[model samples]
Target: MGINTTKLKRGFRELFGKTVQAFIVQLRMETGLMLIENTDLSISEIVYRVEYSYPASFTQAIRNHYGKTPQALRCLA
Candidate 1:
């Protein structure tokens, strides 16, 4: 697209009610949660599947979004 970066950011936020980064993080977290809940994949595997290079960072993001660790969420599922 020929859209300016600033204008794209503005339009994205206006349309989604969140910054693009936040939206991406949210998508990653949601994917991670779905995997945790429905699959037998390990936490580290899920982390990588969500494009996170560091399991610690992915764990922290999950905790922040779901108030639980991936393992904890998996146990619940």
Candidate 2:
């Protein structure tokens, strides 16, 4: 799609009330949560599955977004 950056950002914010980066991280965290719930994948595995670079970064993102680490979330399962 020939998305113009200014328009795309504006449209995304209008539609979702969030920036693109926020939307992407939300998607990553949701997939990470589902993987934690349903799969026996390791934290690192889940991180990479969501296209995250490292375990700590993934951990921090999960913590920031959901207020729990991947391990802690898995423990809920």
Candidate 3:
């Protein structure tokens, strides 16, 4: 089955609560995956494109959530 945008919107509303930081972090997670899966840009470029002020913080968050480095995930595809 595929995700519907309506369901996805509702899901995000429920999961992210009302905190702007939580919402932005979730957005970063999604954007990071899109960058890794769909583009040839390096991880640093992805970090900047996502508006993360600290590359190390973004890298750590990505690693903590996905259990893999961006470089490692790139190799999987």
Candidate 4:
């Protein structure tokens, strides 16, 4: 899929109170989806691409957003 720059930008503007937080949230969401779709790479590798502070943070965010663990999602796919 392509980047929905306009929609994403507008989403950030509305959903995030701050620009930086919005950017990071968007980064995390986008990267999380990439991680879900592509199983070739490890979660640790994907964590960095998403700019997560640590693996735990990435996993926590994934869990919070999807209501499923990364491993669970991977297995389902």
Which number leads on TM-score? Answer: 1
* Candidate 1 lDDT over residue span 15-40, tens digit each: 99999999999899889999999998
**Model 1's lDDT to the true fold?**
0.93
lDDT of 1 at 37: 93
lDDT of 4: 0.76
In model 4, the runs with Cα more than 4 Å from the true position are 1-20
TM-score of 4: 0.65
What is the lDDT for 52 in model 1?
100
Q: Ten residues in a row with the worst lDDT in model 2?
A: 40-49
Give the per-residue Cα lDDT of candidate 1 at 23.
97
The TM-score of predicted model 2 comes to 0.90
- Candidate achieving the largest lDDT: 1
List, residue by residue over 1-77, the lDDT tens digit for candidate 3.
49997787777778766455678888889899889989999888999999888889888889998998888888887
Write one digit per residue (lDDT tens) for candidate 4, span 24-77: 786787777777677567877888877887989888888888888777777887
Which residue runs does candidate 1 get wrong by more than 4 Å?
Answer: none
Would you list the C-alpha lDDT of every candidate in the order shown? 0.93, 0.91, 0.85, 0.76
In model 3, how large is the Cα lDDT of residue 4? 90
TM-scores, one per candidate: 0.95, 0.90, 0.71, 0.65
Model 3, runs deviating above 4 Å: 1-18
